[model samples]
Target: MTDTPSPLTYAPPALAAREDLLAAVRFDAAGLVACIAQQHDTGEVLMMAWMNREAVAETLATGRVCYYSRSRKGLWRKGETSGQLQHLVELRLDCDGDTLLALVDQLGVACHTGRRNCFYRAIRDDALTTIADPLMDPAALYGDAHKGHSHG
Candidate 1:
């Protein structure tokens, strides 16, 4: 006997209106937007990064994350240096359509200093408190800090 199909089955949209979404955002002359990376599960603000047009496209296309590195003046793939990669979950735009919020599934730590999030320091009574410790050594990720610095 042939079995009947389930009624709960659903299909995806015909096509994602990615371009329309992009057009809604306001990018600067650098073709970049201020992207805020947030932890999906915890709602914790991990870090703030920049995303150029190419970086935004790459992040959405690959599902792996991408950012515009101001210091490098190029694209930056998270975890390439520190192994603290962020996997894109969802991308959100603020009500004003100016800012971007990236909901991500992060691996290992998020901060370069090895902390779970970059916002480890909290201000209490006008005093800063080290609420969290580094998960990995900074030197292991970015090399020696005392060395010559280069800006992008």
Candidate 2:
């Protein structure tokens, strides 16, 4: 059984403004949008996740970064199992209104591989190079729960 998300209770004026902002967003044909999580203080880009309208609403409602997992086909709360929760500091929308930027105070590692961020690889000397070290064991974090999980 799935747990119903608690309704987002926000201040009246803030809620109205948020409603307006949400209304202005242009979701893609698949009812999904790209939400890029960025470090709140250092301005470092963390991981990118998919967010439908419900995900966005849940994020605002909870102040915890939530995403729609394509693999699970359900709403995924960040760091739920990994202890790498992202606390939303600010939310921004691009001029095109199709993409979202979530500035957050990330805890622990952001990547499932135990890296700080998913974009820990870079093109160096014309070759892809790893840029960060794994902070923790993903096996320790998730165990065999996600063993069958695959990125499509």
Candidate 3:
């Protein structure tokens, strides 16, 4: 990231268009790769999802983060249905190119359950414990469209 006002990476748009970026990525046979979203300021992991080449391109083109939903078999713009959007701060590829780390300015709740993040549970003394609580009512955000999603 540069000292630019925008959170986008400091790279030429022309370079981002080249196929080398997507070509270098190693998508699985299912044409999907893991994408982890993190808060740019606090380094808090928001959530983990999958993305395809199109999703990557869209995110790079627009400052908004996008992901591929295996369930929908289509592009899943981070907070399209909900208002909690994630604007891309920076995109990083792991050394192996198998995973992605997305630094973003998370708006509102990052988790669909209205929590700040998805990892709300932890193993403490051999027991599953909730470390956080929902900040908002999930039904108000998702409209009950995606309930019972096992974040575990």
Candidate 4:
């Protein structure tokens, strides 16, 4: 029989690149990175927030969606308070591997201001315009002087 090359002798570079990319992720001193929220179906960018490794792990594990709240300095489960939860569909890293794109199956409004997205304002003719209206009232959702609120 003719000599054949062994399959184990070849390895894809993509595998090695992914490993390196994972290793090089820079977390802040508090071990948090900014994560961008996106609508899975419409591809609309909702908002951006911080997340720690624990948040990432927990999100992947539970698939209910979680984030690191910089204001409260703790994990925030989406929809726990406002009833506007985001179900995790997939998580993606940017080309440089520093940024994160969270594709989610969002339920109800995604913005605290009652809008469908945080980016409700649009720029036109060098002026800002309100493109969308809030779906829910903040006062009704969070109440007055909303403090120490947890979605979980």
The 0-to-1 C-alpha lDDT of every candidate, in the order given, reads 0.74, 0.80, 0.82, 0.72
Across residues 12-50, which tens digit of lDDT does each residue of candidate 3 receive? 356545366677788999988899999888889999999
**TM-score rank order:** 3, 2, 1, 4
lDDT of 2 by residue, 6-118 (tens): 22422223677778878988999988889999987787888888888888888877788888888888888887876878888767899999999988889888888878888
Q: For residues 64-147, what per-residue lDDT tens digits would candidate 1 score against the true structure? A: 678888877898888876677888777778887778898788888777766888788889889999999988877776787414
Q: How accurate is candidate 2 locally (lDDT)?
A: 0.80
For candidate 2, list the clashing residue pairs, or say none: none
> Which parts of model 4 are misplaced by more than 4 Å?
1-24, 145-152
Which TM-score value belongs to model 4?
A: 0.76
Query: What C-alpha RMSD separates each model from the true structure?
Result: 7.5, 7.1, 2.9, 9.8
Per-residue lDDT for 69-93 in model 4, tens only? Answer: 8777788888887788887776667
> Once superposed on the true structure, which residue ranges of model 1 sit more than 4 Å away at CA?
1-16, 144-152
TM-score of each: 0.80, 0.86, 0.87, 0.76
Against the true structure, whose lDDT is highest? 3
